[model samples]
Target chain A: MAKGSVVAIDIDVSRRLGDRVIAAHFTTGPGLTALFGPSGAGKTSILNMVAGLLRPDRGHIRIGERTLFDGATNLPPEARRVGYVFQDGRLFPHRRVRANLLYGHDLAPPANRWMSLDEAARFLGIDHLLGRWPQSLSGGEAQRVAIGRALLAGPEILLMDEPLSSLDAARRGDIMAVIERIRDELKLPILYVSHDRAEVDRLATQIAEIGE
Target chain B: MLSPEEWGIVALSLKVGGVAVLATLPVAFGLAWILARYRFPGRVVLDALVHLPLVLPPVVTGWLLLIAFGPLGPAGRWLESWFGMTLMFRWTGAALAAAIMALPLMVRAMRLSIEGIDRRLEGAARTLGAGRWHAFRTISLPLALPGVLAALVLGFARSIGEFGATITFVSNIPGETRTLPLAIYSALQVPGGEAMVTRLALLSVALSLGALVLSEWLVRRTHGERQRRGD
Candidate 1:
């Protein structure tokens, strides 16, 4: 574990999907901890548990000194203050990029907000696309906006679930560079999920192999 | 081309229909949201109750409404004592009956739209720090707007066409409760009243057709918008 680790989690959770039971248990003291595994390895489920979108049957999740979930307490997603970048850029279809990016920023308390909308937009190179709708943007641009939206919420930790899988090679490279900046520049803790070993090797500071 | 009396009837019909729709819109949306989002023990029963007005005889629905909302009944007595209001043989009673008749259609339209929304988007909103109500207000509700508008229009059309319920609940008193359908019915009863009945009936058909066309157009426009956006 790195000195003054940003996140620590040990959780056990399972859910039944038809005949299959998907389950995950992991403990990490992290920089950017990547859960590397195959498609059905329950990596996303672990992230969901960390973000409070899923409940763990046992164990606990802690960010710094704050307990997000344990045997007795489970914070809801909104209260957990986690920035989540989904596989698909789940931007609001009705909103333009500016509003999508600002949605979380405005909901965040002023004392907790770390970056201005313009700063985050410029950092993600999405400042030019603010007026455009999510549907009008290419997959890459939309993903970048998704990241900026998450970051502007001033989360203690970020969760990225195979955010590069849908992009072309060139776009993947661009987003990988952005992820590097997030890890190095902002130094935000991240729990990333990916099946691609090469991607994990390049981006993750600590890799936790999930499943077989 | 209507005489002043005929025009008055049309205006009255519009008033009752408009009020009925406006009054029912929030309640219908609430019910639709609940039905679309949750799975409770008696969800099916609640759903069936909402649809009861549609399947039951309109007169029966009206009779139930009369029992509940009459001046001497529980709700009616409370309302009379508290607000000094009565739905008894008044235009307001006609509006109430029309609204009840229209509720099922409104709820169905809104419920389908609410259910069709990608709940994942709401999850994303929550991860972005929006509370449940905030996510619903800003995300889910806007996405469901076209359906809500369609519901309102459909409910309005249904309200104007409501005759059996309105007459059963409030009776057909001219000016007070005689809407388009009731006016046509009244005209049909008099000697040499065919011309008046024909005019009112044509107006009724025209209004209902216009509403249905508008509702269809709204639904189609939403689909076209979604497709064009490649959603």
Candidate 2:
């Protein structure tokens, strides 16, 4: 594994579910790297490890120049500037759309406020939806909000864990366009997890196949 | 005739129960979060012990409190020496007994609510730079607020109706430790005071119904928020 600009992430994480083993070994760079695998192939686990939600049994994870996890140095999720988008959108239920977006912006350092709340809303096409509550959002709309929230964090990297899995095909198509727009706009790295090969082909510049 | 003493009993019961519940809420929330979200060794044992008051007779709970908080007990002596406070045969003693009885109910309701929240929401908070407590305060606590409110109201109602533990620990001393339930029990024990007990019973029913209505309103508001969220 080379420690250089070309590889934005280097991970070798293994987890066991009783006797079964779901393991991954990969190094990904600035563009989108999709982890394509079957169900239960540990796609989500890898994303969780990168986001510091699940500690890998024995491995290391580094994003850019910072070490997010190692056997000894497992940075808590808050300390690791890695953004995560769960499949269900996971919007803060009590928060209006603007407050949810601001929640992320507030956590960011002052220097990262280059993308103001207004800019973030405009970028995500969510300006009109800001005052609305989360329950009012369609599946596509909610995922778009989730993406904007993550981006507002000024994270060094973003991890999407099967974000379109719960949506209908039509909804997924709508979000795919939003995601592509995000990729074009942000220079940050993204580790996208999905079992769908078509999504991988459409979104990923690099592909890491997990499981058998 | 409904005497002023009856009103005193009602006021005392409300005061003691409300104070006890308010005092225990922060602790109950902490315990519920620990039980619902974490997996530490002996956690199951701790959880079971918290619920022991529910299963054990209230008189037994009172007996335990008496042993630990009686005038001659070590805790009682320490409280007197350190804080100049006493619990034996006092209204404070009744509050203590009620708090112990109400704790499990509060914890259980909060625990269920905490568990019901999508864990992914907390994970989302963390990635947004919230530490554990921040995540809980902003994400977990708000989402599970309906359950927390339910727990508090249930605990308050339970404390108001406390009898066995209050009688055993604090005794039914008028104007000192006699709660609504204790007053009602004493009235029933007398020859002609049964009519007085009937009025008190109606009061009890009214208080409990009020609490239930409040809980329902809170739940409806939270449910409406969830509906708006499209969940």
Candidate 3:
């Protein structure tokens, strides 16, 4: 019956380069928290562990009232109910945009399903591109579709790991604006990892600066 | 025009090859998926076992199959006792032998395709409330489809061309297990059978070439689909 204590991580794992260890311990309530750090700072690594994609060498991860990972209990990624938008968009190449967006909806509990297809598409400004293939989309359009896909999955927490880093400056601004809109309107907890200080400043309510 | 007897050999070869590919495909994909996606102990041993037929001489492979699947063998006896099925010297046994010969190529092609896929896509699927099976079905399998098609083509072609393994496992018997290659071999053994030899030889070449062309077309279609979508 507890909510809003979205993510608690006290873990140590090798950074992306695998040369050194980065230890982190933090807890954030419902809001957009930015993990700002330089390249190779292990921001994505931490996010990955949250999504159950990777396991921390030693630590506990509690999202909401659920103990996701520890010595005893390790929930699979599918059980975590975390939505992730990657840097590359990672949209299903063979699936049409609509199908990609609805993939998570297929498995999400009905009670937890809040966002509709039209609502997600319109919010992300991808209503018209739903029929097209992901490979055909421009960088900005693809990222929007990715966001829409994640949103439709009915996730308890959204993880954006430099979702805009691959976009050009103009596209970056557009995506950042959409992300801000999501944070304000959805009120879901998010861990947005990025190196752009301005992006962190503009959208993040809480900032955890890592690396240089 | 070919005689019924000549046509039977052609028809039998096609049937055996087609059935072999169908049977091998499920096993090939399962093994290929495991080899490409998971890293566990003795993975190399499993890989080696799958590829053993390819490396060994065809006669040796067939001898091994005969020992394992022959009516006197434990597996053969169990199958006969339990299911009333007998693989010894039957056309079905020919198909099994052909499937074994074709399996390595199919697995190799499928494994390459599976490996080429981005694992991160599956990761994305998992976060979206998809379990391991769902992610594999929607993401991994679809993305690797072109490769799978290619594997099927390769398997089919290899099955059609299968000679040594089939003859070794199940001896040539007309109307039962005498496929194109076996028929051709029999024709060559008879005196003044040079014309029948020529005809069967032409048929075998045409069939093998047809499979190759079909495989090539499949691979091209996949590539075109990907390119059309701008991948």
Per-candidate local distance difference test: 0.89, 0.85, 0.84
Residue B147, candidate 3: C-alpha displacement in angstroms = 2.5
Write candidate 1's Cα lDDT for B62-106 as tens digits.
899889998778999999999999999999999999999999999
What TM-score, computed on C-alpha atoms, does each candidate reach? 0.91, 0.91, 0.91
Local accuracy of candidate 2 as per-residue lDDT tens digits, A1-212: 11113436888888786787778898878778898878878888888888888877888988768888887799999888888888889888789999998897898787654467777787778888988888889888889899888888777777898889889999888888777765655655788998788998898888887875
Per-candidate clash tally: 0, 5, 0
| Candidate ranking (TM-score, best to worst) | 1, 3, 2
Instruction: Go through the candidates in order and give each one's DockQ.
Output: 0.56, 0.57, 0.62
User: Could you say which candidate leads in TM-score?
Assistant: 1
Q: Which has the greatest DockQ? A: 3
What are the runs in model 2 whose C-alpha is more than 4 Å off?
A: A1-7, B1-3, B189-195, B228-231
Per-prediction interface RMSD? 2.5, 2.5, 1.9
| Alpha carbon deviation, residue B2, candidate 1 (Å) | 2.6
State candidate 1's DockQ: 0.56
Q: Better model by lDDT, 2 or 3?
A: 2
Name the lDDT of candidate 2: 0.85
Worst 10 residues of 3 chain A by lDDT: A1-10
